[model samples]
Target chain A: DARVTQTPRHKVTEMGQEVTMRCQPILGHNTVFWYRQTMMQGLELLAYFRNRAPLDDSGMPKDRFSAEMPDATLATLKIQPSEPRDSAVYFCASDDEGTYEQYFGPGTRLTVT
Target chain B: AQSVTQPDIHITVSEGASLELRCNYSYGATPYLFWYVQSPGQGLQLLLKYFSGDTLVQGIKGFEAEFKRSQSSFNLRKPSVHWSDAAEYFCAVGEWAAGNKLTFGGGTRVLVKP
Candidate 1:
């Protein structure tokens, strides 16, 4: 079945550490989105890319978080000096051209100590 | 701006009982509504979506939802509940424009009692 795939399904790290999560969108999909899920915040959009170009990332923390789509199949979210508040599930989703529905990956659960 | 609201934080229903989850939205114009199910610690799965044409839309897993324009509500319903159906349900609203960013609701957690 066609599905989005994410790496490091779960992660635990110390504060001030660097964490990187990767995602592989379904083939032929050009739109990719990054979202963070937490208990306090149900779900929030962090960033989105359209056709390998950054479209909107206003929801993201520009200082510490960065998202990139290096190629059609690969998208990555990275955080430096991660804080405890950053511990949450990160999900990547993608959609093909002109499609309204977004297919989400299993997600990467990050735990910062 | 588009927004979604799922009022019930949690709901418990016995297996084989009927189920309903409430969702409301706010938008300047007609919006694309979606229902998603998320198993514990899993990604959200699309249950159903309503764009246009029919007000009542059928979804997978024997789920359905009706859009009421007067109330700005799109509620999800199931004829019979199953244990596997116990999960978190999210309501989302999106505009199908240049940016398809979806505004999601807080979500409602459903529990099925055997």
Candidate 2:
């Protein structure tokens, strides 16, 4: 079975540090998305990519966060100068077609101190 | 802007009992709807989705949802509940105008009792 894979299942970083999360979308999938889940904000779409090109990043913090799909198989999300409020579980999902169903990775739980 | 609303924040049901979770959305144009389930500290799992055809869609884990265009609702339901079914459920709408972004509901936390 195909599934999205995410690395660094958990991350602990101090304020002002840089954090990077990685995701490997299922092979043959053309679309990838990054989402942040927190108690305050249930799930916020940070960014998404189609065919390795970003389709939207408006929901993301432009100054601090960045998402990129380096290749068909890999996507990444980075946070520079992380803050305590940035602590949350980040999930990466992908689908072959841009539609309602998306296959999600296990997720990376980040705690910025 | 497209938005999703899950009226119930939390729901509790006994094992073997029926289950229903409400979800509503607002968006212009035809919308794609979806339901996702998340276990504690886990990523989301797609339960089901509606993209035309029959308004009712069946999904994995014995879950189903009905899409009602007039009410802008896609409610999830199951005939029987299991303790393992307890989790956080999210309803979402996929809109092209929103750059294909999925607007999700606040989520409903299910607590199943034995």
Candidate 3:
């Protein structure tokens, strides 16, 4: 079965470090979303891409966080000078056109010390 | 802005008992709703979703959720619970106007006892 794939299942970094998480959405899917999950915030949509073009990133911290889908198969979320509060599990999800159901990948857990 | 709320922060139920998790949402127009379950160290799994047509939607693992537009609620239910049902459940609302970005609830932690 097809599934979304994420890299760096766990990452530990000190404050002020840069963190990069990668996602490979299911092939043939046209939409990809990036979300951050925390105990306090639950799940927050950071950004998303449709048809290899970013549709929204308004929910992300523009100064420090960046999300990009350079190609259909690759999506990336990066945090520069990450802070302690940035610790959370990041999940990537993908969906096909004309459907609302999304398939999620195993999340990447980032811990900023 | 659109938002989702799951009133119960945590719930404990015995195995073989019935289960219900409440979900409430706030949005001006009709929105797509979804329920997902997240196991420890795993991504959120879609339990059910409501777009239109029927009010009740059935999902995998014997889970079902009923959408009540008048109450702005879509609650998940199951006839019998199992030990493996213990997980964090999230209710979400999709904003169709804006690339369908989903806003999720704080989540309800379910504990199943044998």
Candidate 4:
């Protein structure tokens, strides 16, 4: 079965550290999305890309957070100077053009101390 | 701006009992509605979506959701609950004009008891 894959299923870092999470979308899927989930905020879309081109990243903290699709298969989300408030589970999802449905990965759980 | 709201923070039901989860949305026009289930430590899984035509949409895992334009609601339901159904459920609204970006609700946690 086709599935989205994420690396570093769990990450624990100290404040001010940099953290990077990676995702590999299912082959042939053209749209990729990044989301962060926390107890307080629930789930929020951080960014999304279509055909390796970013469509939007307005929900991301531009100062410290960045998302990129280096290629069709690779997508990454990085956080610089991470804080305890940044601790949350980040999920990567993808879908084909015109398909309203999204297939999500297992997600990366990050904890900042 | 589009938004979704799931009124129930948590719902507890006995196994084999019927269950329903409420969802409400605010949008200017017709909205693309979806329901997703997230098991602990797992990613969200699409349970159902309502695009057009049918008000009642059937989905995987024996789940279904109905779209009511009058109420501006898309509620998920299951005929019988299973222990495996204990999970968090999210309702989302999407707009095609908005690059298919989804606005998700805070989510409802379901607890299935024996």
Top candidate (lDDT) = 4
lDDT scores in order: 0.94, 0.91, 0.93, 0.95
DockQ ranking, high to low:
4, 3, 1, 2
Q: State fnat for each of the candidate structures.
A: 0.61, 0.82, 0.79, 0.89
Candidates ranked, most accurate by lDDT first: 4, 1, 3, 2
RMSD of 3: 1.0
TM-score (all chains, Cα) for each model: 0.98, 0.96, 0.97, 0.98
Which consecutive 10 residues in model 3 chain B have the weakest lDDT in total? Answer: B94-103
Count clashing pairs, candidate 2: 0
lDDT of 2 at A23: 99
Compose the digit string of candidate 2's lDDT tens values, residues A1-113: 98899999999999999999999999988889999999998899989998898888988999999888777888999999899999999999988675546889999999998
Candidate 2 vs candidate 3, lDDT winner? 3
Order the numbered candidates by TM-score, best leading. Answer: 4, 1, 3, 2
lDDT of 2 at B44: 92
lDDT of 4 by residue, A1-113 (tens): 99999999999999999999999999999999999999989999999999999999999999999999899999999999899999999999998777878999999999999
Instruction: Kindly indicate the candidate among 3 and 4 with the higher DockQ.
Output: 4
**Model 4, B1-114: lDDT tens per residue?**
999999999999999999999999999999999999999999999998988998999999999999999999999999999999999999999877867799999999999999
Q: Ten consecutive residues with minimal summed lDDT in candidate 1 chain A?
A: A93-102
lDDT of 3 by residue, B1-114 (tens): 888889999999999999999999999999899999999999999998899989999999999999999999999999999999999999999887776788899999999999
